[model samples]
Every structure is written in structure tokens, then in C-alpha cells.
Target: MSTSWRDRFEKNFISPEKKLGLDEILEEAHDAYLGWLAASLTAFHSDFNEDQVDQLDRIFQGESRIRSIANDCYNYAINGRFRLAKDAQEQEQMNDDWVCLAILVQSARPGIEEFSLTVRGRPIGVPAKLEQLLFHAQIRALLDFSTVDGFDEESVSVPQFFSQPVPGYLTLKEIALLGQMSERAVRNAAQPAAADRLQTRKEQTQTVVDATEALRWLKGRRGFIATRAD
Candidate 1:
């Protein structure tokens, strides 16, 4: 029996190659990551209805597989490898990271976390904690978004929806859209400039909290003492 085109592709392109040395492994991982990112973004776009795709295409300036690859690359580089953990404990930790990222993304908008969590099958409990962790990931995502100088502004800010700290799960875009008069209005008003403002507000809030915590920790140090009232 002969192999079909699909079977040939499965055997050649989809199957994991033999493990290599550390450098080679990283190179291979990077290549694989790029391929996976492209596929995933294509899948995401394909999942949208024609109207939705048309709206996004206008806002984003066109279909952008490169932007998708860049996003995935940034994620992999900052978060390290995406390999499943070796044991149940490690797997749980991985799950925790995913949940946290989902929460952060959801918080920025609203529906994003739920959408990502539902799609990813993350648990509902301890969502707040997960969002905190995702805040860190969102920071990394932000930095990466900033690095791609030529990417469309609207596309760049779209990821900010994942950087917020909101209650429960929601996808980034969904949360952002909830504030609009209606879903159609949101789609019509989609602009990178607006998204940037929302992201800036969230980051500023996080900075204040971090500074406050630092001050509190300094006050609690062994040698620190509060000034007495005159």
C-alpha cells in the first residue's frame, strides 16, 4: 500500500524529529514554533466568520502570518520552552501558568480569559491567582509587541487584551468589545490607539501597586522604624 498526501505530510512535516544537541534543539524548536504559530493563527482566522474576518482584515491592514509568528516567538522566548512537564506535579505547574496567562488576558478586556480558558480547558478555581501570573506574561508580551516596529498598530495592541487583571475568564477582544455600545460598534471602532490607552492604564495601575508593595516591605524590614508624631 502507498501513502496518501496527508499520510506523507504527517510522516515528514508533523512528526517530531530526532533530538539534537542543545543549540540544534533550540533551532529546531524555533522552527517548529514558527510553523505552529502560523498554523494556529491561520486556524484562528479560519474559525472566524467572513464578516469578522473582513472587519479584522481592515483594522489589521491585512492577513498577517508574520505577526502571528512574531507573537508566538516572543511567547516561547520569554516563557522558555513549551514542553509538557515530566511528572504530574510539573504538569500541574504548566497548567497553572496557562491559567494565569488566560486570566491576565481576560482581565484586560473580559471575555478573552473565558474564551482562552474554555478553548484551553483550564480550571475555573483560583482564577485570580492565575491572572497575577499572567500579568507577568502580559508584560513580556507587551515588550515583544513593542519590538516589532513595522507591524500594524492595531494588530500590535490587540494582544493587550491578554495583559489585564480582570475577574473570571474572557478573551482579550471580547472583553474590549463589551465596553462598546454593541458588538458591531466594537468592530467598527476597533483602533490600535484606543487599545493602547487601555493597556497604558492597566500598566500604570500595576506599577502603583508594585511601588506600594515595595514601600510596605521596606517599612517591615528589621531596621526600619516609623517616624514618631511630634
Candidate 2:
């Protein structure tokens, strides 16, 4: 049997007499996607406890809604309804949402990376635990960077969201290179933001940037990101 949203999508293509605009078509497709997602989660719920099932439902549903909204943003970007900066902002938001979706789904996925065994049936090892923590931190970092919500799923050019680098640890030399400054200048800039985030070793004598902490700093202090000429 065809679903309500599925019927709508099918109608959009099959009902030649009916005329719907691009925006309407996008909404119909997005709603169908949500319906598919809800059905998938309902199936997955049988394997999880109440708490985990709730969380899984929330994570999937959350992105499903965001995808609908961001699809509009994507349309605006392509249609030139807004400025270049607006396009960039939409691109960045899409990127953020994509990252969040990956982290959330993988963190909740049943199987370990190395094997097909579900977390429900087996004890999570050190690697799995670390992966979960890293996902949480990435989510927090995304929140710290943008007050606006994030989104993704549709394919597009320009921003290349999937290809963008996930923020990673920055060595002193790397930070300096990214900032287009001397190593001394990088150290000076780090000093102010280094209060609680300083990750150092007595043996190494060099502070390292954990990926999440590094993202927070890079997002705000994007001195190295050269802007296109207006």
C-alpha cells in the first residue's frame, strides 16, 4: 500500500493535469523522506530499550525535519533570492548538519565498526566508547560554532559539504600556517584562548589541540580563511 506522503510524491510525477511548483515538489519529496525515516526507526526500535529507542527516534526525526527546512535554504541559494554571503551561510549550515547527522547515526548504530555485532548483544570495547565520546564532542562543537540549527541530505555544489575537512588536532606549526602568521604569533594568539583548553605534555613541551577544541578556535578565529573579493 502506498503511504500518504508517498502518494503525494507519486502524484507530483504522475498527475500531469495537476500543476505544482518547484517548492511544492520539494516539500512533497521531503515529507516522503520523513515518512520513510519514521518507518525505519519503528523497525529498529524492536532491538533497543525504551531510552535508546527514544534517542534513536529523536536523532532520525530531528534530521528529517532539518532536511526539509535546509532544502528551502538550498533552493534560495541556487535561485539567487539572497546574497552571496547568504549562500555561504547556507552552505556552512548544511555542512554542520551533515556532520551532526553522521555523528548521531553512527553513535547510535547497532554494530561496531570492526564487526557486525550489535552493541545490544555485546560489550562495547574501548574503541567504541571513544568513538561515542568523540561524536558527543563534535555535536557540542557544532553548537558552539553556530547558534542556528544545522541540516543536510540533498546534494549540491559550491560548498562541497561532504568533502570539507572535519576539524582535527592542530600542531603549533600547523596553526601558524593556517593563521598565516609566524609560530610566535600563533603562540601569542593561543595564549588568550588557552586558559582551560591547553593540552600539553611535560615531555613534549608542546600543547596540542583536540579536534573539538580546535574547531571552536578555528570557527571564531578564521583569520586564515581569505574572503573572495566583492
Candidate 3:
């Protein structure tokens, strides 16, 4: 008779005969979760060569919540409070869970950032003026929020351009220099939150602006466009 998961837990996972240290298992799982993100990004962005992929993966490892959760799960599993390895297949099941959660994070990142700016934009700290600039009604006309999920509409090779961010955008610091204001002032003014998420991570919230669009935006703010329209 083959041993069951519950049986294996009784025999080895909690016993002195365990095959691997809990800490080692946790580290391995954490690496695998971040590695999954690297793999997905590589598929999404051809311009993100191996070196760039590796660099981003390292950054995510440092910042992501996924790794932290996995570490916690492993520690709990080893203490006999819960049983994950009653059988040979249980470890693989835990890995699948990690992978699924990582993908969910990758998929939802764009939407989350957009929502953050629209709702909780304060903590991220946009210059107060720029904040209003970003959230102005006309801003959506200048900033695009959609993503390409597939090429079913395409009849040829996918446009490599999709792998990168749309051009004509600048960071807050750049905008500050162009506006001849202190960066702090720019952040203080940066408000209203725009949709700034990306499927390929081309830009982050409060980190991108369109100088030309901003000029147009400022005109409206100053009543030039309003006056012209009136």
C-alpha cells in the first residue's frame, strides 16, 4: 500500500527524519515565486533581455509581498500546526499555490496602482499641484490606461513596441526641472491621480508625465483653453 499524505506527516515531516530544513524550503519557494515573475515579464517584453529580467527579479525579491508570505507559510507548515506533506505530492501542491498567487499579483498590479492614485494618492506623495494636474478631467484624454492582452486582432507578428512604454512621458523630477520649481513643490502640487499603471511596467504612479500634454493641461488650468473655447 502506498503511503498517504497524512501518513507521511506522521512518519517524516514532523519526525526527526525530515529530508530538508524548513528554512531552506522557504528560501527555495521564495526564489521560485520571484523567478515566475521574471519568466512572465520576459514573455511580455522582448526588450527586457536576460540581464534586465534578472535585475527586476532581484528588485521584486526585495520589495514584493509574495516572498514574505511564502516564508511565513513554510514556517507554519513545519511546526505541525498544519500538515502540507502527508504525501510525496503535497510539496508540489504548495509550490503551485505560490505560482498562482504570484501571477495574480502580476496581473493586478496595473489596476491596483490606478486605484491607488484615484483614491489613496496621498501616501504615494505627488506634488500638490501635479496631483491636480494628473487628476483633471481632460487628463484621461492624454494618458492611456488600456493594455494589450492578446494579438487576436492582429494578422501578423506582434508589434515589438508593445514591449515598451508609450513615449513622450517624463518623471516628476524632470517635470520639476522643466517647470523651474523645486521637486518638493512639484510633489506638493501633483494631485488628482491619473491612470498610470502598465502591463509591462513602463511607468509607475507619480513617476510619469507628458511635458507637451502638461503644457496643454496647464493652459486649461490657466483658462487659456477655457477662454478660447468660450
Candidate 4:
């Protein structure tokens, strides 16, 4: 009878004496978790928009609450604290949780759209694709924030262009190019009339100096010094 029981046990379980080491199990889990994270982030990135990306960048720049929520979800997924194993359901839940947290973090911003919008400016509600894109953008932003050194914590001020009531907007490519230009050169390139208008507006209204203005101001000062008599 004992021999028969032994045989049955061996048949039912291939490894009666051998067991998976904790480190080995954890390593496997880590690899799987990382894989899932990468795939999900990739899917999200494929459809992200500029606005959503900006929001995520802010969150990554050390928003304490956002960090906490994301860390909680990550810990739960990696440690298998909320599930028996990292299966499909677990992976989906982790992804969903991350998206939810990102939304919450972004919603905290002032003047943020209510995760809902229509192409025609009507209230059609937020689509799943948009939501996913926003979520992914936030992730990217956070990652960028983490890698960036010496980011300013204070809110940035913007300037109006062309004497218009509305603020000016620039394309990403334009902005990148502008960043490479010397401050003096940028200001020097601005039309004298436009520069005068900008100065007048600056004196009249309380506006935060933007990157462009900073560069222009620096250039102006340098030119003034160079032309001055010794």
C-alpha cells in the first residue's frame, strides 16, 4: 500500500523533493512584470497626444501623490501582493490601475479638460483611445521628469504674441530649434517693432518671462555692453 501511495504521489507531482528557489521565482516574476509594463506602455505611446504627454511629464517631476499611487500599483503587481500569480487578469488590473492613477494625477492640474471632448467642441465624452493616450503621455512625462536634472518646480509664465489677447503656441520642432539658438541672436532677429510691442506689454501687464523672452533679454544686454565705450 505504501509503495502504491509513493508511486501515485510521484505521478501526481513531478518534483516531490525539488522546489523553486525564492530568488528564482522572484526573478521570473520580475521579468514577466517588466515585459508586461513595456508592452502596455508601448501600446499607450502609440496613440498619445502632446497635452497628455505634458501632463505625464509634470507627474514624473515628483508629484508626491501621483508617485504614491503609481508605486502602490507597481508594488502590488511585482510582489504579487494582491493576486496569487501574475496572470492575464493580474496584468490587466495592473495596467488599468496605472491608467486610473495617471488620470487622477492629471485631473489635479488647473484648467485641465474633463477627460471628455468632441472634435466639434461638443460634449461627446472622453473616448477610450483618448484616455489611453493621455495615460501613456503621463507615463512618458514622468519618465522624462525622472531623467531630467534641475527642473524648475515653479510654475512657468507665458507671453502673448503679435499683441493678441491669446497666448502664442509653437510646434514641438520649432521649440526644440529655438532652444538651440543663442539668447542674443534670437532677440536680435525679432523685428524692432515687435520687440517694442513686447516690451510695452511687459511693462503694462504682469507676465512671466518665457524661454524666448529670457534669451532675447540676454542677447539685448550683451549687445548693449559690446557697443558701450570702455
Best by TM-score: 2
Poorly placed runs, candidate 2 (over 4 Å): 1-23, 42-57, 60-78, 82-91, 97-158, 162-230
Clashing residue pair totals per candidate (backbone < 3 A): 16, 0, 22, 5
What's the ranking of the predictions by TM-score, best on top? 2, 3, 1, 4
Q: Write the per-residue lDDT of candidate 3 for residues 66-181, one digit (tens) a residue.
A: 54544433333222122223333654554454444434333433433333322111122112221122112112211221211222113122211112233556455433333334
Question: For candidate 2, lDDT tens digit of each residue in 13-119?
Answer: 22211222345434433333333333344465533443553465576666355455434333332221211223666768655654553433333333332222333
Q: Can you tell me which runs of candidate 1 are displaced by over 4 Å?
A: 1-125, 149-152, 156-230
Query: Best-fitting candidate, measured by lDDT?
Result: 2
Measured with C-alpha atoms, the lDDT of residue 117 in candidate 4 is: 24
Q: What is the Cα-based lDDT of residue 54 in candidate 4?
A: 42
lDDT of each: 0.31, 0.38, 0.35, 0.31
**Per-residue accuracy of model 1 over 80-102 as CA lDDT, tens digit each:** 22232355565455444444333
RMSD per model, one decimal: 21.9, 18.4, 24.3, 26.7
Better of 1 and 4 by TM-score: 1
